[model samples]
Target: MPRVVSALAALALLAWSVPSAALQVRLVPPTPRQGDTVMLFVGGTKGARDVEGSLGGQRLAFFPYGAEYAALAGVDLETKPGKVPWRIGLVDGVGTPRKAAGILTIKAAGFPVQRLTLPDGMVNLDPQSEQRAANEAARLRTLYDTVTPERLWRGRFTQPVASRKPGEGFGFRRVINGQPRMPHAGIDYSADRGTPVVASNRGRVALLGEFFFAGRLVALDHGLGLYTLYFHLDGVAVTEGELVERGQTVGTVGTSGRSTGPHLHFAAQLGRARVNPPDLYTLPVRD
Candidate 1:
């Protein structure tokens, strides 16, 4: 009876010494390339509730994954190649807060320089047109920078064009009219005039208007600081504030904005990261 009691006491002591399983997460591609997207996989919270987290300061949008959850991490060109941090917080059943954190390493992505010799007037706009371009850029910045905390998209994103191809790549160091210009920040698709262009994902139409450079354009907000823009559109099928599904026709290809030929300029913005539109196509979706 004394031996039995000793064994019981030893077992109890071991249990007390062992720490509880932590509610923590691991970063997929723990080191992400600039302009890429990574997945944050939260583990040990199989049955836990109210899990929340952030990767490199950008708020994460979690989706159910069996018992645990996962979130998408966007790494933009602005993310300098270096180490960053990841964090998570959860309230346990007893209302106690649990927290965890780790570091993320960012790898460099090199972009190529592009020299486009468009007409002098097209490259060097007059004062009025320059002001219009500035205003258009400001309007877009405000929209992309706006944070809509809800996740409005489902499934992986799709290309706006049927071919799913790109013309000039994103992050092109542009030199136009012998003057350096802001790097081309979007993926261009060569399409016939009147060809259909669809929403990259389910989203609400945020803006539809004519601009000096983009021409008739449509902007869609997929919430969670994710926004997609379709430029040089010939026809706008959706109106501002309209909800559109993935692959739904939002506009038609056109040489509307300052363009030499009909094409679709499809761009995606995740918070401040002007990432490649196709990067969104690779993000996993939740049911």
Candidate 2:
């Protein structure tokens, strides 16, 4: 009887002393390359509906759970060199409280970042371009205000439709008339004028309009201010305010505006900040 009592007490003590690693999340790349997108993996715990994820000092941009993992966007891993802290915690569907966190390291790419150029005769347009850029910047601010990082953490991302071959580089520097310009904002995929364009993930149609540079465009809001823009589209498949599913056809590729050939300028945006979509695609999503 005494032996039995001692065994039970010892077992209870071991249970109390050993900490349960409820969830094991590590930023896959301890030292992520510049312009790299960091992905977090969860282990040990299961059945979580959403996982709150944050990078640097930012709050959770998307909540990912289930078999699929959620990801953050607009990370310029090159700009901020050094250790980047990340945190993840589970969200209880019924209001039970539980959470966890971990740190991630970031290393410098050491390569010179790319830049674009502007036109020569546009030298005198400084005030004009500055005003326009400022206006656009302000618009982005408004968008980011509504799309907090926390809201994006509500769901996991669905697998993106394969492009096979992407056309444009995400941050390729451009030289216009021997003057530097803003680096390219998104990735471009070569396709026929009418090649179908699908949603990278589940999202709502946020903006459907034309712009001087973007041409006929469609912006899908994937909650939490996370959005994807399809520019130089030959046609729009969905209307404004329409809820689109992952892989749903939203538009067709084209060379509608300021383009040399038929292609789709696929861009991903987190709030007002532009991020490289290819980075998200490169990360291991199935895990």
Candidate 3:
């Protein structure tokens, strides 16, 4: 079913708190779990404006909401469970700069363990593959470290595939050949070879190329430090620096890199926070 969340329903589901004071701040879901997206709501008389904030020192972007301001925050899947401080500063309608601070108790999340056996050579990268992976990692970091402040993506984020068929769950502890590897950060959707993959939201294509493990890939810069990545593609249709709509075709699914079958690995990032793309789709943000 499509996720259409109402304003009233959004409050109940997020477990947000409203303070009695005229000016107040609340974190949706109150306590954010790993691989989750967070929404910060500021309530005030004449409302909040020019809102600026940060979590763990990463800059946050805020949008004006009538008399108040709100911002989207991403908590990385690799974040350790503990107290995380988020600070906010905003100039009200009166032009007075007001600031507030809060602590988000990063809660623990449970992920399933997945063990799979692949070809020995595939599991172990060769020298050439290692070099490619290293170069790609450095290139990817340069793209992610860039923080775009524009609000390019609007409304609720949609699935890249029309069927919306679910695949492997995010945050899985992946073990290959008895060796534990990095946790699976993105959710997957199984599709046939040459299955078309579309953009999840409006954004400018940042990078498009064949990588070591990602295979044919496309990454979008959705502005405000938000990015969505599509990996293991059979064909890359979009080029770098192209603006794409929410449902624009980006690539095709295939068993392109270090894989056993055809699938699309969709990943999301907010600033430097690598989050679960599927989890972000559940949020109730409007244009």
Q: Predict model 3's lDDT versus the native.
A: 0.82
Tens-place lDDT per residue, model 3, 1-287, is 23555766777756534332445887887998988899888778364456788887677887765556777888888899999998988776656677888788988788789998988877788898788888998888888889787878878788897544666668998999988988887888988888889999999999987887788889999988889999889988888899999999988888787777888888998877878787667776656
**TM-scores across all candidates?**
0.86, 0.70, 0.87
In model 3, which residue pairs have backbone atoms overlapping below 3 Å?
Answer: 47-67, 48-68
Alpha-carbon lDDT, every model? 0.82, 0.64, 0.82
The best candidate by TM-score is: 3
Please say which candidate is ahead in lDDT: 2 or 3. Answer: 3
Show model 1 residue runs off by greater than 4 Å: 1-19, 46-50, 63-65, 164-168
Angstrom error of the Cα, residue 87, model 2: value is 3.6
Candidate 2 per-residue C-alpha lDDT over 38-91 given as tens digits, one digit per residue, 9 for 90 to 100: 555666544555566677666655444454345554466235666666676665
By summed lDDT, the worst window of 10 consecutive residues in model 1 runs over: 162-171
Backbone clashes per model, in order?
A: 0, 18, 2
